[model samples]
Target chain A: MTTTIEPRSGTAFKLGKGQFLEVVDPQGQQVSDLLAFNAHDTAEVISNGRTFDYADTIYLTTGHVLYSNRSNRLLEIVRDDVGTHDFLLTPCSQDTFRLLYDELEPHQGCFGNLAGVLAPFGITEDEIPCAFNCFMNVPVDGKTGKFSVEAPLSKAGDTIVFKAMMDVIIGLTACSAPKSNNGSFKPIDYIIHDHLDDVA
Target chain B: MTTTIEPRSGTAFKLGKGQFLEVVDPQGQQVSDLLAFNAHDTAEVISNGRTFDYADTIYLTTGHVLYSNRSNRLLEIVRDDVGTHDFLLTPCSQDTFRLLYDELEPHQGCFGNLAGVLAPFGITEDEIPCAFNCFMNVPVDGKTGKFSVEAPLSKAGDTIVFKAMMDVIIGLTACSAPKSNNGSFKPIDYIIHDHLDDVA
Candidate 1:
C-alpha cells in the first residue's frame, strides 16, 4: 500500500492559552513512544488522568485537540491526512541496543532521544520517567500470545499540530526502529509554526 | 578514535562467568530520569535505599550486582559493552502502546514477546517492574548542572553476562536511538547462559 502524507507545521505557545501540537503519519504506520513531558518535574504528562497511550489513540486527519492533565489546552491539530499511526512500541535505548545486538557493539553510548531533548531544562536522564511513544504499531496475539510489528496503518505526509498549553519543554525523536515494522531508513521531516496572535 | 571490542566465539564456556556492570560518562555528561523497578512486581525498584540519583550514581553497570529488599539477587548483567546504559526505562506494554503510540495497534499482540518469555512460568508484566540501566553513563555536571549522553567508556563488544540464579523470567528491549551513540539499526544479540543448573 502507498502512504500519502501532507506537510504540516506549528510553533510553541502557552499550552492552555490556546496552543496545540499535531502529528500526521501518512502511511498509517505506527510510531512508537511519541510523548510530551513536563520538563521541570519529568513526570509523565497526562490528560484526563490517563497517560498518553499511542496505540489506543487516533489522531484525526484534522481538527483534533491535544490536552494536558490539568484539562488545559496544549495544541490543536489544524491539519492531518498522513493516515493511521502507531504508538505501541517505544524508542530503543542503550540497554536495548546491548541486549538485542551483539555484545561487541558498545551500547553504553546509547541514549534515549526523549531524554536528549530534556537536557536543556535541568531534566537529566535520571529525571526522565516513563515516556510516550507517539507513532508505532504493536499487535498482540491471543492464541500464541505474541507481539509483532504490523504494516503501516497511516499514509505519507499527514500532519497534526499542537499548541503549547504551558511554557513546557517538549522533546521529540524522529524514531529509527528499522528492526521493527514501525519504521524504515527513510528520513521524515517536520514543520513547526508559531501560532498567530489572534489564534491564541 | 578507534572503538576497542572483545568478541566471544566458539565455546560458550570460554566467556567470563562473572562480569561487572558499570555506569559512567567520563566526559562529564548529565543523565536524568533514571529509574529502577522489580522485573517481577512492576513496582518501583530502588537502589541504595532510593530511586537512582544522577549525582550519586555513576555506574548501574553489572559487576555491582543488584540486591532485593529481601537481600536476593534480582538481576545481573549477562551481556554488556560500553560504560553506560539506561536504568530508568521499562519494556513497553499494550496499555502503553495504546496511549503513547496509536490505539489501532493491538495491545495484546505486542505483549506476547515479553509474556511469551515469562508467562509459561506464570510470570506477568505487572510483575515486571521498571529496571535500572546498568553500565549506562548518566551524569550531572556539578558546575553547570547539565545532563546529556556521552560516549560509553566501555570497549566495543564487551559484555557482562548474567547468570539466572533462579527460574526468574526477564523482559528486554533493544532500544533504537541512533543519536544515543550505542548500537545501530541492527538488533543486539544476547547469550542466555549462566543458568544455575543446581538451583533448577
Candidate 2:
C-alpha cells in the first residue's frame, strides 16, 4: 500500500529482508531523511561513517550499499533518479533553530519528528545517528574543507529505491528544516514491494 | 601541571572559562580525540555541525571557534602548530576494530576510553558525539565527497592551544587506531593554564 507522510512529520515502521522501499518526491526540491536499524536489535543501526568508509564516496547513488554500526549490510540502493545527497549532517533539531534562526517561533526539526516516531520502537533522541539524506545537496570545498547546504537537485516525480538487506526498522521524515527543503515543505510519498519468496 | 596520556589511553577533566588547554604531540605522528561539554549541563555538548555551520570551514585552525549544541561558544583555537584535524568521525570503538581490522586482539578504541573517564562526569556512551580529532588527517574528495583517514602531520613538540569560552568538561584521548597514527601509537602531552582573571 502507498503511504503519504505529511510535511514536517515522520514515521517508523518495519521492513522485512529483501523488501524494496520506493521513496518518491511528488514535488521538486523536498528533502527526506532516512534511517535503518536492525529489527531484532535496535543497537545495530545505520552508520554513515561505516558506509562512507566502504562506499569510498559521500555522493552515494545506485549500486552503493548502506552498512550498519556493526558493519553488517543493511540496505542497497537499487535505483535512484536524484543522485545528490548528504551524509555528514545529524538530523536537525530544536536547538538548530535556536542557534541558527531568529524566528520568534521555533519548529522542532527532523530530529524531533524522527525521535517522536521512533520512540515506540525503543529508540531515544540521543540514539539518532547521522541520517541518509535523500535528495539533499551539500557541497564541500576541496581546498578549505568547508561545506554548505543548497537546494536539492531532484525534480518532481524523482524516485529512489532501497532494497533491504536485513529485517529492519526504518525511520523516515519529510524534513522540517526550512533550509533543507529550499525554504518550503511538502509531503513525501512511498510504497513497499515484497520479494517473490516473501509473497509465496 | 603537565599530564601525559599514555599511548592509546584517555582522560577527562574540568576546564573553567578563559583557561588555556595546550595539547602537545610529545612524539610525532600521534592523533588525539578531544570532546567538550558544558559543565553545568552535560546535554549541551560540543557540536561539529554547529561549529562547521558557523565557522564555514571543516579544516579548523587558529582563530576558529567551536560551538556547543545550544549554539554557545565553547572554545576558541588560540594557537595551532598542525592545522589539519578531523571533525566528521565518531570516536573509534571496539566495533570499529572488529569491522575494519584483522587483529587477533581488538582493543576497545578511543570511544571505550572516553566512555570510561567521562562516565564519572555523568556522560554516557550514547551521549558522546563527534569528536575534534586533533592532529588527525582526513582529506575528502571535492567531487566524490569520499574521505580517507591519513597519518597525522604533527611533529615532535607540536602544539595546539584552545581557550575555553565556557566552563566545560573535557574528554581527550591518545588515539588507538593505527591508521590515525601511521601504524604507531604514542603518548599525548597536555597542560592547562588559568587566565589572569581566574588567578586573581
- Tens-digit per-residue lDDT, A1-200, candidate 2: 67999999999999999898988888989999999999998978887766875676768999999988666899999889888988777677777776667557778888889999999999876567778999889888977887888999999989889999999999999998888889999988888887523221
- Poorest 10 consecutive residues by lDDT, candidate 2 chain A: A191-200
What does DockQ come to for candidate 1? 0.04
Question: Across residues A59-111, which tens digit of lDDT does each residue of candidate 1 receive?
Answer: 22234444443223344445544433432223455554454444555333213
Q: Can you list the residue pairs that collide in candidate 2?
A: none
TM-score of each: 0.40, 0.87
Q: Find the candidate with the highest DockQ and give its number.
A: 2
Measured over all alpha carbons after superposition, the RMSD of each candidate to the real structure, in angstroms, is: 18.9, 3.4
Tens digits of lDDT, candidate 1, B107-166: 342233444545554544433334443333434332222234444444434444454433
User: Which regions of candidate 1 deviate over 4 angstroms?
Assistant: A1-17, A24-33, A39-41, A44-49, A52-88, A101-111, A142-145, A181-183, A194-200, B1-200
Q: Is the docking of candidate 1 incorrect, acceptable, medium or high quality?
A: incorrect
